[model samples]
Target: MRDRGLDVLLVTDPANIYYLSGYDAYSFYVPQILAVTHDRDQPVWIGREQDLTCARETTWLDREHVLLYSDDYVDSELHPMEFVVDRLDEWELADGTIGVELDADYYTARAHQAFTAALPTGAAVEDATKLVNYCRMVKSEAEIEYHQRAAAISERAMEVGIETIGPGVRKCDAAAAVHEALYSGADGTGGDYPAIVPLMPAGEGTGSPHLTWTDEEYEAGEPVILELAGVVNRYHSPLTRTMFLGEPPAEAERAAAVIIDGLEAALDAVEPGVTAESVERAWREEIAGTTVEKESRIGYSTGIGYPPSWVEGSVSIRPGDETELRPNMVFHMIPGVWFDDYGIEISESFRVTEDGAEVLADVPRELIVKE
Candidate 1:
């Protein structure tokens, strides 16, 4: 953070706040901001009075530093200049460059406007979210442990999901089965977050990679695709699997074989020096001769928060992404292939190891045809 020429880093995005401070507030309808000095020690949380208990319990904030306003005090209504002046007075901050998250919503921008108004005679503001996120890309020991537990629950849920793929089961029913399995909690440890509701789709429904469970029914010998995640401890590990009610139809079987092979090819390419794009390229090369349509980028970095990464958004996902793969870096390689009317998705969570990548979940990638 010091290298970024920042005096303080302000985090207004709730997910980013949870990542840094461990304060998971349910009321995302309003805005919450975290102010941390460039030294990156002791983040001060400014939020609603209703969240005072949550701030005190979940965050490392000192009681005096956790500022709260009443429910009537809408953050958006705060004058940008007055809010900045107050924070400067409270923190005894001198003239220096303040930093904030660029992706932070309009409320954060309003805060920035207020700060600019105060200006403190000669101060600057810069976007520090990228720098903070770059630090978050690598997993800490505690973060990895949370993900491991989440992944284990997700694996158990996958087992139930696979079993529910037979003809009599509906997509909604399959999702419910997986949800119940994950909610049961693996190793008898309960979760802090809600159980995941999987999206179990079949046939044409599988064309949409992010499809949700509907009233679709699974027919014998039809391909069934499930995108499952277990949200635990405010973190999640999502995995995808495709199966057949009985034996996989010829087209589905072939697509699954190709997808499984591509996933292996991608995993084999993951190493400390490898770029995200290179890993994706490796997967694409494996499917070059296959008939299935393929997207360029294959996967993303993973973390404790649900959906720590995005497929299409401000998050970059290309080969030149200089973010080198490092040990303890978790990622999801969820590559699925669709051919004709058949689709199969095989995915797993992985943590980059000293030598290569280690699979976090034990769910098999093979086409499991339940009888």
Candidate 2:
């Protein structure tokens, strides 16, 4: 806070709240904040009275710091911000510069207004939305283990997905088998719900990246793409693989090879001194004159997340992103290609090591073709 001249900091992003205070709950839909000050060593977690028990169980904070407002404050004419502001005033922080998350899930407009109105003095609120995210860019050893476990779960799920999907089978049924394997995880350790459900888009629908599954039976000669993650301790190891039921068209095979080659080229460029865009350029150069092409970014940072999406919103591996590669940082390198008729996605979740990127999954990086 001193480095940024922030007298107080209010974190409203649930992922960030969990990052700072380890306060995880299904209550991120409501207004919550983890307050920090330079004067104190520990942060304060603020949430609804109903969730205080959850906070006590999950957070490392002292019982006193796990604060709560009355249940009467839940979605009423008076917002939870009123009580938060009152607490700030009582704590003598109303006159100080408070940093608030502007683009956060819980930092709604009403919450912003309440905080702004409560600070009568020149006490200002600044945008610190990406602050905690940037801090969490690199992973700790323990976090890597979590992601590795997640990757193990993902590998088994992919196996199930591959085995269960075929001609005459319902798409949803195949998705179910994959889901079962995803949640079942590896032996001895159980997996948590992923930030995203299995994204299994098949045939012509593959052009749409986010499509799930259907009740329709799989047709011969069609391709299916599976994009999903295995989550453990909120850290994710996402993977994607495409499969063809029968003999894949010559064009499909060629496109998959080009993508794999481009991805390898991109991976080769990932080292401590390289820039994010420079890595992208390696892939772009690899597919420069090829029939296949990809316009979207090929990769992005990934780790600890909540629902709606698992994208690490902090940094992206794309053109114009000048961020340098750092050790212990993790990413989902997706060279997802969408054609007019269908799409192909073969991705890997990996960690940046001192030498290069270490892919988490042991699965073969190619289009899996089976008769």
Number of the predicted model whose lDDT against the real structure is largest: 2
TM-score of every model versus the real structure: 0.86, 0.96
Best by TM-score: 2
Candidate no. 2 TM-score? 0.96
The lDDT, on a scale of 0 to 1, for candidate 1 is 0.71
The residue ranges of model 1 lying beyond 4 angstroms of the native Cα positions read 39-41, 79-85, 92-95, 104-123, 194-197, 306-317, 338-342
lDDT per prediction?
A: 0.71, 0.87
lDDT: worst 10-residue window of model 1 = 306-315
Clashes per model (N, Cα, C within 3 A)? 3, 0
